[model samples]
Target chain A: MTDTPSQLPAHDEASIRVDLQLVADQIKADSRVLDVGCGDGMLLAHLRDTKHVDGRGLELSMARVSSAVREGLAVIQGDLEADLKHYPADAFDYVILSQTLQATHNPKEVLEGLLRLGTHAVVSFPNFGHWKVRLALLLTGRMPSTPTLPESWYDTENIHLCTIKDFLSLVDELGVTIEAGFALDGNGQKRSYKATGWLANLFSEQALFVLRH
Target chain B: MSVLDTSSDNALAPRLTLEGPLVLQSGVSLSPVTIAYQTYGTLNAEKSNAILVCHALTGDQYVAGAHPVSGRDGWWHHVVGPGKVIDTDRYFVIGTNVLGGCMGSTGPKEINPETERPYGLLFPVITIRDMVQAQARLLDQLGIEKLFCVTGGSMGALQTLEWAHRFPERVTAAVPIAGSYRHSAQNIAFDEVGRQAIMADPEWRQGNYLEEGTVPTRGLAVARMAAHITYLSEPALQRKFGRRLQDRENLTYGFDADFQVESYLRHQGSTFVDRFDANSYLYISRAMDYFDLAEENGGNLADAFKDTPVRFCLISISSDWLFPTSESRAIVHALNANAAKVSFVEVESDKGHDAFLLDEPEFHDTLKGFLDGAARTVGLDDGAQGESA
Candidate 1:
């Protein structure tokens, strides 16, 4: 009975971004999920339609929140840093944070909040130690910029950008168990390098992880 | 933009009178409560398709058709027709003249069975909770076990929130647009000024104007004129009618309404007095002022909604200073604290508080989407489009 096309585009299984696809592959079907920075709810919608997951989202932008809600996804307009403490412990089976951890003011605190709120956590972030980034910083003596991390350092939202090695070190510091990990290349294809090896840190453009408390 | 008209000519509608005495939040008991309501569309056999639409301070029960009194179209006619966003073709819409309203409801204008005269100031002071309680009673009489949704704007939003807080089991989804958990100090101050204007009029006769054979026309008009200014943003006012002269070449060099804004306010005030009771304004505004959801739930707004099953969608206008987007955000934080399923939208608009009643496509579209999604979750099949009546 609706007359207008929804402001939010419907997400299909094939169209979901590779990082999100990797994150979705780790989550059990029909599990309760909370997407911490669900931009327009692309992953949540795919999970709801494909796996029948009970998904909810928390987004900061009002425009994205409205788009997500209009697409029939329940999304609260809120920031990850301030709003994560509100959910009770073990409220969801999986809490997903996709490519938004570095943008947060306190990545450590937000990550801890994620583990506390869900039984398992799925996280993805752009790697800051790739060869091209090193080349830009070492050869030019300036801040690095790659296709994945395109924004200039002065105007970038990624204040706490981390390499794969740095992220694994934080995971070790938190004493959380890593269920699985993936190193993705520039084309969003999984690379052959081991996620924990230094080669992955120097070659891969992005990293995805499945962790549990 | 048309002037604000709160009057109703008391067109024919169904009225229900409860048998027992309904207690008030102020520790006063009122007997033989009567609620005037109008229904559009048709109720499904399971009766889960009913949506209770609460009206704002000056609104009546006529929701999607011509008004009985002003002969104007319903306030939300754009959103509640057969093929509209609310879609009378698919849902049963019920609108009620609030408990302390003037449009054929039990209010100051209604006669007290105890004294056989108009209640006037003697009518028991009511609160937002009381209005919701009365509406609940009317639903009980109608055999509606649960409502598909409860929604409103401004004062009506107050009642909608109260419904979700007090009767969560009865409401499946709740939408409170351009509303707050409680009235702010600035809003309370504005209400005070409007009240003082009505009481200052000698013809008011101390809230017994009906018995005195007089009406507080000037005082009420002045109050309406003053309150109307808060409903619009400065930019909207400027765009619609700036300092431009009212049908003249230049200033008249006198106190006459040389400005179009002044003339518009005067017309808004004058017409408002024709159909509204000054005392009802006082009672309704007072109810809004007393509404604090946190205070009602042991001083924690989240506690009021803890473990509640009702889903929520909160909408706020970008330029509504009276009830700004910050208020809706605060409520969202509380709902999130309780892990309640909640959705929020701050519609970009310069139209201010009245945007909820206007033809804001974004607002209407978001509301429809939320309802459509909620309907699916509740197992409301599209086949259940009740026969329109």
Candidate 2:
């Protein structure tokens, strides 16, 4: 028995507004969505209001879950590493893990868990191979602190940091279907489909993949 | 305010009052209580829309209805409202202010019919399990055979865990949020501090402050202020009030609330006193401090769930110093060791103990996904017309 209240830091709510509409477009109208790492429920709120989709989320922060629930979204307070087994197989149409896969102890299992929960799983993360990140790593020989990985190495949540190729290998090894992939600029713009070559691989700031198993 | 049909002669309906005798652990009793409860939607033909929601220590039973005293939205209004998580449109949601709540629930308020005064220190101590027993009696009186879900958090989460253990088949699914079987030493220490703050008050006359028209408001307020700090993280508080001065440009140089944090805490303390009774706070916290679920069943936490059959969606917070992710993992590990149908999630945030009350979008998605899937797996869609609300 949980409900939504307005006790969270207002900064969380403000950051979600920019990505709200695109988040809505990402999920199908009638499909079920399980959003792992849902922050203050901006996307879930959009889904419920614009689409008839049912949304569920798992967040590590009680305050964020508290905010999401206040907005009338169903969310559980949990850590992704130990709790995916509680959900039955093929429970939803889409399982979305965005911007959070990098911070996990085991990103592969989380991705697998997502694929197990939904027919299609959307996984997005910052591409460590981006030219700027690469240049920093190459020049300093220490971890880079881009806008995505803003914290110091010792405190950063980029524990299982990997490149686009590493994620592709994980997908291939898991035998999951690669339904789609997107390359995005630093401005959050989706790049042309033909830009999968050397330039795109080295320059793109973010990577998105839709997988099915 | 709910539509309590005064015209109907339905005496069997549960009455909302601030007076009663609540049975305790040793078969003793406590009197003079207040219970702020809310009933949502309708109980169906079989009369089984009775889902009782238990709340954490700081929570009252303002689930979906406006609180009579707080003038704020119900704590779980988002999850229990129309088309929301609990979905009142399809089910009846019944949450009561637990036995020791300072809300409208009976606490140290009723005049001891013997002394013609409040029960005060005469109130017997209780446990999370004892709280469940009281709720069980209330459910029985309301004609509810089984609950679709027994749900709660922190102290309330302990009760949810106890319900599944005590009345296994009676609960369809249990959702315990940011809770642990045993109150850890750290959490117990915090509770002790709050209790000491109350007892240390000049007005607290050895738990006999009734006749003097003196209430231990200062001590209780300090306790609340301290507890409020634990409920939030350093990051959240820093982001909120920070080191900035409140209402002024610079330090007052005096011992006043020169900092924004002090002012914020002062506000929390003052508001808390207006609604809660000091004595009730002592008793409830003491009960929580004494809770040790594993100790009740040998030394193993898993052994407590060995013979039980309850689906669990146990939740924990990342930054909560009260019941940390490790505690939730311990429960998940035990349930896993017992091979119970359980799912766990550690929502990453700096919100601390109060995370369960905030809006983390992923939490809503996770809960909706888990409950919906559990509903389908548990046959809530078939034959059971009024099991959930």
- Top-DockQ candidate index: 1
Compared with the true structure, what per-residue lDDT tens digits does model 1 show for residues B298-375?
A: 888989898888899999999999999999888888887777888888999998898999999889889998999899
lDDT of 2 at B130: 66
User: What does candidate 2's lDDT look like per residue over A1-213, in tens digits?
Assistant: 111112222334445432233345567787778777777666776776678677777777776766665454565566677666766678778888777788888787888888887899987777888888999989999889886556788877678878888888888999988877777666666764255665666776777777888
Local lDDT at B358 for model 1: 96
Which parts of model 2 have CA positions greater than 4 angstroms off?
A1-213, B1-23, B27-36, B382-389
What is the C-alpha local distance difference test score of candidate 1? 0.86
DockQ, prediction 1:
0.66
Q: Give the CA lDDT, 0 to 100, for residue B22 in model 2.
A: 64
Q: What would the TM-score be for candidate 1 when compared with the true structure?
A: 0.94
TM-scores for candidates 1 onward, in order? 0.94, 0.64
